[model samples]
Each structure stands twice: as C-alpha cells, then as structure tokens.
Target: MSVTPARTGARPARWPTGVGRLVAGAALLTAVALLPWLSGTDPALTVLRALSADQDPTPAQLAAVREQLGLDEGPFSHLVHWLGGLPRGDAGTSWVSGEPVLPQVASAFAVSLTLMLGALAVTVAVAALVSARTLYLGSRRRLHRVRAGTGAAVLAALPKFLLASLLATVCGVWLDWFPSSGWEGPQSMVLPALALGVPSGAVIGGLLDQALPAAFNEPWARTWCAYGFPSGLTARNALRRTLAGVLPQLLPTVVALVGGAVAVEKIFNIPGLGRLALDAAMAQDLPPLQTATLFLVLLGVTAGRLLQALRHALLGPALRDGALATLHQPALPRRRSPRRVAALCAAALLTLVVAGLLRDPLHVDTAARLMPPSAAHPLGTDSLGRDLLARLGHGALRTAGVALAVTAVSAAAGLLVGLTARVGAGLTEVASTLPAVLAGLLTTAVTGPSVWGAACAVCLVAWTPYAAQAAALLEEERASGHLLASVSFGAGPRYLLRHHLLPAVLPALLRNALLRLPTTVLVLASLGFLGLGEQPPTPEWGRLLSENQPYGELAPWTVLAPAGALVLLSVLAVSATPSGRSGTRRSGAAS
Candidate 1:
C-alpha cells in the first residue's frame, strides 16, 4: 500500500524562502496586468463594439481609430502593440478623451495617492500601538489573537468609501472642516483624510494585537527577561528581534487601501488618480485604462516582493529551523460548517447575477421609466425601460462579486504585507504613513476608467495591510517556538503557509472577508452610481439608486429592494458566522 506523507507537528517550510508567496504574488500580478490588454485594445474596445450595435459611426472615424490601435490587425498584433509600448513609457493618447493617457492618469494620481498614504499612516500607528498594548493583556493566547483580529474587523467593516462619504456629508458639508469639492487645497484634504484614516487605524490596531503576543513570547523575549534585563531593554529587544517576522503581512494592507482611494478622492472632489480614472472610465478611454491597471498591479507585486525579501533575510533561520517542525501535524477538529456557508453565499450571489443579467438592460420606456410600483412593472422601471428587479439582481450580483473578490484579495495581500512591515517598526511607520491617496493616484493613473482595469489599478494601493501585519505576527510566532520548529522539517514557506500560517489566520481572515462584503457592495454601487463601475444600462445597484432617487418619492420600493438586499445579506452573513468568531474582539490576539 502507498503511504501518505506522515503527519508531524511542523511548519513544513521556513518563511525566509517565501517562494510560495512570491509565486502566488507573481501569478496574481500577471493576471491583473494582462486584464486590460486582454479585454481588447484597452477596455473601451468592448464598449465601442457594444456602441456600434446601437449607432452607426462614420467609416473614416472608425478607420482612424482602428488604424491607431491596429484593430484591423490580429489580436496578437494588438497585444504586441501593448507590450511594445511598455519600455518606451508610451501608452499612447486616449481614444475617447483626446488627451495624453499618461498625463490624464497622472493628474488623478496626485489626489488619490495623498489620501491613501494619509490613511495608511493612521492604520500603521493604530495597529502597531494597539497591538503592542494587547501583548500586555497577558497569557490568554486565544483571547489575545481575537483582540488582534479586531483591527482587521474594524477595517473590513468600515470600508474607505463609506467612511469617506459619511465624513464628506458631515465634515465637508456641515462642519466645513474641508472644502465641498475639487480638492482645492491642503485644508480640503482634512475630511477625506479623516474618513480614510479612522478605519485604517482600527485595522492596524487589530493586526498589531495579533502580532504582539507572538513577539512577546519569543525565546528572545524570555531570554532578555532571563538575563535580568531591564523592562525597557526587554521590550526593545523584542521589537528588534521581530522585525523580520513583521514584513510579510504589511504589504497586502497597502493594496486594500488603494481600493478606498477612489471613494475618498471622489468625495473630496480631489481630482487625484481616482477622479481621473473615474473620468477616463466615463469617457471610455482605452489607453488610460491600460496604464492604470498596470500601475496598480505592478505596485502591489513589487511591494509585496520587497517585503517578502526582507522577511526571508531577517527571519531566515527561525522559519526554517523552528516553525516548519510544528506545521506537519494532522488537521485539528472541525469547528462547524464554514465550507457550507461559504458555498451558500456563493450560490446566492450567483443566482442574483443570473437573474439581473437576464433582465432588460435598458429601463427606458419613457412612459414607465419613473412609474410607481404597480401591476405592470412591480418594482417600476428606471430612467431606462429596464425592470428594477432585474437591475437590483444584477447590481447585487456585481457588487457582491467584486466586493468579495476584492476583499479576499486585499485580505490575503494585507496579511502578507502586514507580516513584513512589523519587522521594522520605524520603517513600517514611515512606509505606512504615505497617504492612500498617493498610491490611489498612481494605480488609478495606470488603469484609467475600466472596471476590471480599476480593480487592477487599486491592487497596489490595496496591499497596505500586508506591510502592517508582517512584523508583529512574525515576531510573535518566532517567540512562540513555532518558527523554530517550522524550519526543522525543511519545508518551504508556501508549504508552511498551506500547513501553518494560513490556518492560524484563517478564522480572522474569514471574519474580515464576510464583514467586507456589505461595504464593498456599497463602494462598487457608489462607483457605478458615480458612472464608474458597470456603465449605463448594466443594472448596477448603486446606479439604480442614483437613477431612482428623483422618482423615489413615487416608488420607494425601487430604492429599498437593492438597499434591502444588501442589508439583508450583510446581516445574514453576520448571523451565519459561528458564534465563536466575532470580529477581533471575540477572537483574542493569540489564536
């Protein structure tokens, strides 16, 4: 009989190698980079093709565009053309805007980057300090980890867009802390910064808490104590020792923050990268989309790699020698039915998507566009003749899908980046301090206006959490003797992850993943409502709300259906989670 690899308590691989993480990061980056070019000659070509179905264009105009983009050539030719432009820094001019693609994207980058960086700073400070304090909560490992998870929960629950919108409404419009629009000056950034920073800080705090216990319990921490070291010396010694472990998790956090940049920039009328990307998307400019998507993917991959290298270099021995030995053990007892619940959510979302897509694309039956709910159109039609029910279904599906994907990606990335950043506390503070706005601008400039393109655009900015968590967790894990055993088995970093780190963090990650959905739905819909996500007639929930607002007085159900669905899903998800897991608070920092 064939024998399976025997179960052993080991980490299976050392983190310093991080080969598995690097490969995964590479694959993700490549996919994101290829998206815009793969979709067409930029993302707009699909829309152009769709447009041709409705309206006839002059042959001369079409020919000029085709010639410029080499559309008459083979698909490979367009891809080659795209690849050819990369080294030369020439993404070409915008097809729709008639502007230089780079310039348009660059203009927007300024605003988004500033906001994101600012938020990032707040996130790191809160995570680091809060996590440090959580260490003192003392001895209760599971409770400590749960507390640490809180940072992530808060961040997940309070998405950037929601906070930005609320801040804009209150501080910008009412309190007058910042300008109402057009990012006029530094003063204008106040409300947007607050919106972005508050939630980020909470996330950081939670991650730090998770990392602290592991760090404090390290052999070195005990060593310092055993050596009769003073309290300050021991603490400093612990911080210094864990820097290597911190880098892995901090990188992803940055990427998630970029996603927030769009909303923050938009709310403040910052005209940063998010605004530019939004404008380009509304205009369907292909070149801008390509650049924006590339920039975001590139940034995320590069930052993630950098942190990986650092973690490998510093935490090399412990990960290989100690952590791996402990990861080879058999699976623990199952808690309940996480797989079932996840599947159910997935199925429900898919159903909504199918229903929405099958419904009418155009809600414009001028006679029934704004008609109140009645026998003919139960939910009434929108500005277009499209049924509100169909639109709601589609909108819910898209928003939920994008939100889920983005959240998963961001959480994964955040865990990676946060792990890395914790390695160098001072460096983490400095690196995370850059506003999400800055990263937002850079990535947005890269992707321009396309929805998929925008997702790519934000990935780099989205990776912030990675940097924040790395240092803390690694330090703590190393102290816990896990890192020591991890290496004894000679496993690679990827194997270690499959066996160890991921499982440990899974509970928290899952919670964050679920919490991110509701706000993510709001964010996606907001973008669509603002003319960014799925274009007109696509049946986006946010767009529906915006479209129905004028007629909401007549048919309130139109607004309630989409909003209600969103709320219900969020509540259902919260209920579905096992009682044992309740954000960072319930989990404790050590688990």
Candidate 2:
C-alpha cells in the first residue's frame, strides 16, 4: 500500500465549518425569538392572567390590557419592535414581575454559572480518574472489566433528581455533613455538583473505555507503547483522540445536562437560571421565557463552537481528521445474538403489562399499613396501607404509557426533522435549547397537571436530540457513494428514503429511542416530584416516589421499591439496544 503524506494546513472537509454553524445558530435564535407569539397562548391573556388571577376580565378590560401591551398591533409589528430593542441591550420586561428581563436573568446567571462550572470541573476530574482506572484495569483482568462496566452503567442509569434526593438525605439530613438544599455559598454547591457530575462522568468514562483500545491499536500509539512511555501517557493520548472522536456524539449528553439542570436546580432550591426558567415557563411570562430561551441557545451554540475550535487548535487539522475517521469507521460488534436480547426485553415489557392490567393499586387496607415485605405484599405496603406491589405495577403501567406515547411522538417528529435537516434546523435548535423541565412546566401551565400534559411537555423537548441524531446519520448516508449512484440512476427522493435512507437510519433510531426512555422517565418523575405531573392518587412511578420520599426512613421500601424499579427499568431499556459497531449499513436495499 502507498503511504499518503500529511497536509500542512487544510480545513477539515467533513462536518460543518464555523461559518456554517454561525449561520445555523443565527437561524436558530430567530426561530426561538418568535416562540412567544407562536406558543398559541395569547400574550395579552398570559399577561392578564398573571396580573389578575382572582377575577375574570370583560372584553373592554381585555381590550385595555391588549392596547397597554401593544398586542392590538399585528404580529409583525410586535416582532419588529422586539427585534429592534436587541441592539440597545433591552430584553423587554417580565409581564408578571414588571421588572426588566435582563436584570433578572443577569442576577440568576451568576448562581447558574457557578453551579455549571463546579459541575463541569467535577465531571472532568471524575471522568478522567475513572477512565484511567478502567483502561488500566480492563486490560489486566476480566473481572475488572466487568466491575468497571457495571459501575459505569449503574452510575449512568440513576436519575439526577433521584440521585440528588439520595445524596441530600444521606449527607445533609442524616449525616449532617452539608446543608440539604441552598445557594448560600461555595460549600453549598458541592452536593449538587456531585449529583449532576457523577452520572456524566460515568457516561464519559464508559465512552473512553470504548475508545481507548482503538486508539492504542493505532500504529503510532503502538510504537509509543513499545517505547518507554507510561500507560498513562498512552491513555492520555488515547483520551485526546477519543474526545475528538466523540465530540459530535456528546451533543445529546450536553443537551440533557442543560435540560436536566432545571430539575436539579429546583430540587436543590438553587436560585439559578434553571429555577428561573421553570418559574417563567410556569407563569407563561413571555418576555422572561423568550429571554431565557435566547440565552440558552446562545450559550449552547457558543459553547459548542468554542469546543470545536479548541479541539481543532490543540489537535491540528490532520490529527483531528484522523481521529474523526477512526470514530466513523467503528469495528464490527461481537457476534452476540440479537434475538436473545429482544426476547428478554419483550418478556419484561409483557410482565409490566400483565401486572398493570391485573393489579388494583388504589385498594386500601388500613390494618396493613407500613407492613414490611411478606407473602401478602411482595414489595411491602406503603404508609397508607396500599400494597406496594400493586402500586408499582400500576405506576409502571402509567409510566410505560407515557413513555410509549412520548417516544412515539418524539421518534416520528425526530425522523421527519432529521430527514429535512435544512428545513428543521431552526426547530432543532429551539427545542434543543429549551430544557425538558422548562417545557414540561410550560405545558403544565397551559394544560394543568395531567398525564397528557406531561407527555406533551416531555415530547416537546425530547424530540430534538433524536432529530439531531437522525439528521447526522442522514448526512452521513447521503455522503456515501451508493447514494450518489442511486440518485444518478434517477431514484426519486421517496424511493431513496424508503429503501436506502431508512435502512441506514434504523439502528440509530432504535438507539435513540432506547437511550431517550430513561431521560423521559426521569423528566416525568421530576414533574411528578414537583406536583406538576399525574396529580394526586394517580399512582405514576414518579408520583409514588415524590409522595413517599418524606417517609423514606420510616418505611424505606416505599421509596426504594419505586426508585429501584425505575432504575431497573432504565437499565433494561438501555440493555435492550444493540451496541453493535458504528458506521452506516445498507438495510432495505442493495445500495
């Protein structure tokens, strides 16, 4: 084989350039800026509702309110007026509080920035240590590999809010090592940071584990290994390559972090942007919500671009391209039986359905209250004497229904958006920036606490990541040689999508679905925890966890049973997806 020489200075031909991303970012911001008017709630009514909740306003009162807020003007006029103020640094005023949006956001920014930075630091440190340990151990012992894998999965599987609660209960209430919830000082930031960071670190560690071996197998890396270099040095270089390889893949994780922070902030009672976003969305306060959404989009776009730039600067274009090529050309997966995995997942789903259909979760028995596990109650009875097993079944059923609905909507919407990337880029950006918690809260504000509302909210924000993933896969497939030949052969867009595109996209779609389930469950649970999901006596998994948390010590089973089930189901969902090698594959057609 002939050797190819390295180039001195050339832009990475694959993926979007900085200028393209900037244009996309601008487009995304514009789409998000119009959300206030596009949300279907009358801005005048939202303001009126905020201003006067006790009494109904007449037509004349509505008219006066409309004129006062300039809602009488057309949408274009309103849009122009709002857009015009951006150059002057005016973000408009919060309809509810009558204060300037910028000041409110600015004050809250410091707390959120601190929390995020602390969490980031914790994430990097923990990920590096765990990844290093895993790499070293995974090479030496099978048991070590198993242990490391198990630990990473378990850590990653735990929901952030649940983790937060457990940490607060253990460290704050029981051990008294720290305050349970606050934003007082740097000391108060530790628990929340850990709560957020540990799971992320675990995820990163797992990714590193997958990437390090490949990096080590490279010729140059192997030569270095043969030399006197330490394993740590090899691992460090592997990490650099691994991060470069995984940067685009981490978008979903980054989105989840920003989105989930709202719930985490709410739980820890930190007065950050997350909490502010929730509060603003709940009140349907357009000005603040718009400003928050814009800020979030800006932060996300800016951070992503900066990260890409930094990586390019550090690695140089040639090395970065090589790393990316390695990532794109994943090795074939081990020949594990897909049918076996499918059967197990199917069995678990069927059991959930049967238990839900057969059980009566609402039944009461005062005498059996707070009973420990026994033949009569496999999972024990709650403080209210309701059988925990039955409640869990019913809760699982409800959660499953929500998960199914949300997943279906998200998957469908994502597929559409993914296929039509140029048209959907604006939408993807808006949804990605708008956190799930904030979306859920906004839905609750509009629809009130109910199952449908919860589903809508989760779907509203959850679809974008799937869309982005689909779009990315679509782009890759489109670039493949066969697709161009098929196009040249006069294949219509529809035929190409159905035959060539769908097959190439299927694996990722399935993966996205499975990965999204746990996050969806957690978001619903967080809403339930906050009393904005399922309402009372609904027996949703999250509602059960929330209602029973106060009595965690009094009857640990009440809390642990549901929490355990959530974790187990999440694990099962994750396990169900195929972890086969990456890269595009033809499915439905010969192309």
Q: For each of the candidates, give the backbone clash count.
A: 168, 0
Against the true structure, whose TM-score is highest? Answer: 2
Q: Stretches of candidate 2 above 4 Å error?
A: 3-64, 74-76, 137-148, 211-230, 249-259, 313-315, 319-357, 364-375, 381-385, 401-430, 441-456, 463-516, 527-538, 550-555, 574-579, 582-591
lDDT of each: 0.51, 0.63
After superposing candidate 1 on the true structure, give the runs of residues whose Cα lies further than 4 Å from its correct spot: 1-60, 128-136, 139-155, 211-247, 281-284, 309-591
TM-score per candidate, chains pooled: 0.57, 0.76
426-502, model 2: which lDDT tens digit per residue?
Answer: 45654576676666655665677777887887887777666766665565455443555555566777787787678
Error of 2 at 482 (Å): 14
> What does the lDDT come to for candidate 2?
0.63
Which residue pairs show backbone clashes in model 2?
Answer: none
Per-residue lDDT over 1-591 for candidate 1, one digit per residue giving the tens place of the 0 to 100 score: 111222253322234434433454344334433444443443334435444543555666566656765655644554456668878977777665466677666656555666667766776666566556544432222222332143345354454554565566667677876676776766776677667666656544543443344445544444555776666665544444444444444554565455336656665667765455545544445457556655555555566567656765555554433322222222222233445545665576567556656776554576666666666665666665567767776566566667667767766776665444323332333333233333333344455544554454334434444434433443334433343344445666677667555555555455445644665555555544554355666666655655665444455566666654664565456446543311111011111
